[model samples]
Target: MLEIIGVGVALIIAVFLVLAARQPDVCHIARSIFVAAPPERVFPLVDDLRAMNEWNPFAKQPSVRNVYSGPERGVGAADDFSGDAGSGSGRIEIVESIEPAKVALALRMDRPMKCSNRVEFTIAPQNGGSLVTWDMKGRQPFIGKLFSLVMKPEKMVGGAFERGLADLKTLVETAREEAAQ
Candidate 1:
């Protein structure tokens, strides 16, 4: 009986490994939203790491504690976070910024998993407002690939990206309205 159970477990592990090996080496997740505010109006909110706390859904979690380092905005700016499972722990640094248009970040996650990823935000003028896109991309190691077999990276992280963009839209549009009054 014990031998049978051992063989069952081994078979399951083999299946999981095979599936993981079939997954793509690189993973990417992206979500976008349209805000009823111009790119200039929406740029500052994403450009400054400190300002992210105001609209970033992840930062709103009660267990998440954030600390800022480097400049207030532009390259060298970073935010370090420590939190519960819901928020995880990571350090995000602004490695590139292109004013009212693009911002790219280097993300290093420590807790839950140790991996480095790239995050990007692009703001473009559209219909008098702005079209904003949030993107994350990274190379998945064997362990990460195995995890992806259980939880697709796109579905797992894309939802949060969508919610974050929604929150950003509301915040920016509301501010735009208030400013016009």
Candidate 2:
């Protein structure tokens, strides 16, 4: 009876670990919104950390809070966020900028489960509109890899990214439309 109980407990733990290891190698989420205005106008709304609260999907939710630091509207700007277990806390810094051409940021976050990830956002001009891509890349720790056997990372986070992007597209485009009129 004792042997059976130990084996049962071990099997449960193994199942949980396997599930966590199968996450994605590169988790990417992007959405393009064509503003009647120029990239210069639309990009500013996204490039600024403080400005994001106005349209960010997470910002709309009550569980999250964002604090800004560093510069005001350009490179070196940073924002720290904390929320529910899933939301946790993280900081983002503007890493690169080329005026209306491109802007990029580095994202580092500490999630609830004690997992961490690195993320980046790249914005580029395309046909008078802007193409904004949100990407996250990180390696699973040894234990995380083992967990992946049961859970695929991409599958786990990809849906959230997709929804977030869709919401962003709507927010930016609507704001731009309002400004134009």
Best by lDDT: 1
Compare the candidates by TM-score and give the number of the best one: 1
Tell me each candidate's TM-score. Answer: 0.95, 0.71
TM-score of 2: 0.71
Misplaced by over 4 Å in model 1 are none
Structure candidate 1, residue pairs in collision: none
lDDT per residue (tens digit) for residues 57-96 in model 2:
5555688888888888778888888888656677777887
- Alpha-carbon lDDT of model 1: 0.91
Worst 10 residues of 2 by lDDT: 26-35
- For every model in order, what is the number of clashing pairs? 0, 16
